[model samples]
Target: MSETRSDSTPESGRTVNRRQVLARSGAVGLGIAFSGALSELFAGTASALGRSGYGPLVPDPNGLLDLPAGFRYQVLSREGDRLRSGEGTVPSNHDGMSAFAGKGGSVHLVRNHENRVTARFAVPTVEGITYDPQGKGGCTALTLDHRGTVVSERVAIAGTAVNCAGGPTPWGTWLTCEETEDRAGTNGYTKDHGFIFEVDPVDPHRTGAVPLTAMGRFQHEAIAIDPQQGIVYETEDAFEKPFGLFYRFLPNRPRGGVGSLRAGGRLQAMRVPGVPDLSSVQETGASFDGIEWVDVPDPLATRTPVRLQDFGPRGITHAQKLEGCYWGGTCVYFVSSFAHSTEGSAADHFGQIWRYDPAAHRLTLVIVFGPDTEVQLPGESPDNICLAPGGGLMVCEDGNGAQHVFGVSRRGEVYAMARNRQNIGTPEAPEWGEFAGVTFAPDGRTMYVNCYTPGTTFAVTGPFHG
Candidate 1:
């Protein structure tokens, strides 16, 4: 995956590539590694696709996975194929996605499968393995083109449960996130359990399951909506036993400026206000950084679920596996695939990129990955994040599957554009999985990545820097 080395910077040392032994280590934007075909010719001119930029990487383009030179990615759909809504395909793990842009230009993907009714999937018209033991996980609604193909598809939310990672709602639609309430023991979960549900990705109503329970339930992950600033960001895929919190919904219907938090919102959790609300949090290796902002007073419920530290502890640190969240520029970024230890108690190994400078309410960390030698990586975390309009930052790496969907460079340098590890090509030729929800196309120039274990969806366009 490493190639083209002109060397203007990035010599922290260590280099190997294909054999996998690279790591100049550093991350955030604009440098280059994994050989990146000579810095992908200075990272421009692949096409004007989605304009992008960012900086921080002294040189940490996380070595190997290729796709920096003149960027390009296509593959609009996959997962047993057969879309247009014949209602047969789609059924896998694929998590958190939300692309919107349909007036005619076409594109509305809401997708999120995370199926767990017993796995199986592959239902192209019910030939085999459509197995609906109870069906459970859901979310779907494609409508691609821009090269990612697939013209129509639906199913916005099925059996329900476990659906993981979601965000995108200023009134457009999409809030998926169902991460779980207690399904670990095997219980259907028809009661509010782990919530947040709203979809309309240009057509999705298979009975239209709507459960914004005011946006609260617990165990949910990924979801960040501000719609100009209406506020919604929530995340927490509880690894196990812990009240697990991180929320902020506040929309009781007030986009008077850019609102629409579902019209009836107010959900809130994660009480950094004096800290100490505990039940769980701090273990995935634990490390903890700094970023504090707490006030949900009780968006729906959670003045106490588990741990706010018993009810007295605030000063930052607490994101671990927080999974993706985005709002680039002014800042709102959020990711913690791992990190927690500041009395939170044990867990660490890398991943920590925080932000929330809501003008300067504070809360910052910016970049903080771990491996080093050039950027050496065995992989264990760093999930969902997006901001590549020409700004840098598109990581997915939920560890394993071969993991690949990194692009950190607001100066932290980390390449590996797309690599879902599938050595094949069908459904018209596609191969960009495991890259988890990374959108763009408001003008970002096409780029719709997905592939959460089986629910694939791609549509990347050249770097086209010019």
Candidate 2:
């Protein structure tokens, strides 16, 4: 973790303290108004209390996941578990994922493996869907019945690298992103990496190894789609000093079904007139109006990286660790996992959640996580995020110490929903891994999440609020 920095912004009058932002949650529409299960979370006053959610979480007797008393989790898949297809075992480093409706009332989960060339278990390279034979990262599909029992699992796409966080499309497809900018011959990769690939939940054949180049070639993290205009919003998770830029793609064929993004689109990076670094602004409810989008001169990054490209005098805005992204209500929600002044960020903080309203051409800071002395707490570096079926938000912690899945209620209260007790390390050194891919089934009955290390996926069900 980085040292904490001053929570001051250059702009005046627009900045508000975190406490004030929570107190005026209703006035600023703090809660997300997304459709379906993603409706109202963070609408009321925000509370930093730990027990405000479903009460204290009870320890699990199985030495796996600890949840609240009434809630229970079933292990759907593990890293080395053999796939039903017999092609290979489940890959390592399970990251971004999304759940879709499957055949006969089942649920189909498309998961990503953040594997590199040195990974032990690589996503099996199926003939037609394999992109680059040397690339060691890709996605897999898991099927769970209504009873939350594993039905079948297989490889969705293969021959990619560093498959990190991605988002789902309104047209029932999953967009898997590669968080890398490695070239073909650099890392033994036969093809250029760092592009988004669309995967169809039902049919693996539909998702060939074609990368959506029009979506830009950079260290892609996650993406969210606007259903109305079919605009695709993307986040770049570049670890370099310049950090990454937020992008939006205007697809030629707006909302077409599968394989539409491959038709090519105009990619653009976001720019806030005077704001060059997002971390510099620490005030909650800090809204930036008149947000501008600059067209990328080279989306392919054939010469210069997208973030380094010239974007006029008022260059594009950059954020460190730009991770999880989702489309809710009429706006797009994104997360800057964390920032460190030591790492060249303008400031330091735990995390931030920003809402971009396309209709209003405005961007507002809905939530700002203050520095936490205890890294094991709920409000640390929040990575992947999703809406709870009942209401509120579910966040994955990627900070130090104990890792947990936190729930933020409609009133903005944060609580521990689940904890990972799987000790992948030795008993003398007990190390717990971070959580990722927090999503809910369409029926709102089952919640699915992933454990990054030792790579495990679990389906949790209980008396949810919805």
Candidate 3:
């Protein structure tokens, strides 16, 4: 079994320090006020921990979003809303996104639409702009003016499958991943699906609609690129028996030479010693030492499950539903959506957050969500995560009941930041949808998020430095 070092101490089967508690019983705000090292999460506020967030969320008069007292929001774009190009409407199911600085002091966003191959709302069909006409899943680029208003929105890339969550590259591009593993000629798709495509935030129209096949062909969820090492860390949202394995792509050139990732790279899976069956759901706050990566024989899973066949016997660790990831504070922080013990698992938890330190060669458990209930931990399923301009991480919930964008302090205290208030529910088709595409603008003055339902994108601003 591999060994792990905790706070410079050898992990010879010892308990974690009590002060190292990752999460409290209820909201993270309660824990932050008492946590000496993490009290800065709510620094300027009163010492008393009265409310859960910056303040009570003021109800939006338009009935779309509800944010804290001082925070304000405006709609940037919505599904079915006509684009500034007047060519097509904004696609539905806005899933993941990243923001970039534009020419005229504007912010450009390359947003994903999690629609399947057969969707009612299709991106605009243009010459030399789509990958597969049969597949309706793709990405859209929205240009926002200096005032945070939508300047022009158009189809950036088209003809993909289930363009879900992706990350921004230091070289100024968006790596959009197709969540589905459906292959060519299956399900009406002319070409094989499930690959990462690069979308140019500045001008995707000129960017080739090509998939970075070297990244691997699997059920992709999100990715975070280490700028210094030119390594791409990815997550898989698979829930099958074998589950998904966390991956890192080491490009042929350590610094991503002229060809970048398209130059072809080696795919490898992560391995942590001491975890049996390679699953981490059973362990909470479990530390590991001597992390290792094993090479993948095949990047594409043609005959068998790529995760199971390549890393299962090799002892590579597996996560139930690893979702979002972000590179911040010289480390990579990611989320394991959810897993349980009822299905013969090691442990059960609503959600989890992990931190991987490349320099130290360590993977640490940063946050763990407890069991779910009607009232406690209202935001359960953490889908996509992003780093805040100030400190801490913002998580978008994809779980049940009321969905919200949750904030986790550096000390691991979780609090509600925003909630969806759109009431478009019907008896047959529910209206509530999880929040996705949570990103901050270049200047850090504004934060943009999406409500997946009647799809609306919001630009939020407030005293976020709390």
**How much RMSD separates candidate 1 from the native structure?**
20.3
Error (Å) of candidate 1 at residue 427 is: 46
Candidate 2: tens digits of C-alpha lDDT, residues 124-234: 899999999998899999888877788889999999999998999988999999999999898898889999999998887887889998899999999999999999999
In order of lDDT, best first, we have 2, 3, 1
Best by lDDT: 2
Q: Quote the lDDT for 164 in model 2.
A: 95
- Model 2 accuracy (lDDT, Cα): 0.81
How large an RMSD does model 2 have?
6.8
Q: What does candidate 1's lDDT look like per residue over 1-466, in tens digits?
A: 1121111122122112232223332333322322122122123423433334322212224422335445555666667766667776666767778787876576677777766556667222221212222545777677766545676776666766667778776667777777765433356543445666676776555225656666666677887766577777777766643435566666766562222444676554443322332213222221122223444333334334322323223322244467788765455666766554543534444666555544434443445454443233424367887766655556777653345666654333465566555633465754434567777766677767776655667676774232
Model 1 spans > 4 angstroms off: 1-67, 72-107, 111-164, 167-175, 178-194, 198-202, 205-209, 212-216, 222-303, 306-319, 324-336, 352-381, 385-436, 439-446, 449-459, 462-466
Q: Candidate 3: minimum summed lDDT over ten consecutive residues — where?
A: 28-37
Each prediction's whole-model lDDT (CA): 0.55, 0.81, 0.74
lDDT of 1 at 129: 17
The prediction achieving the highest TM-score against the true structure is: 2
Say which prediction, candidate 2 or candidate 3, comes out ahead on lDDT. Answer: 2
What lDDT is reached at residue 434 by model 2?
96
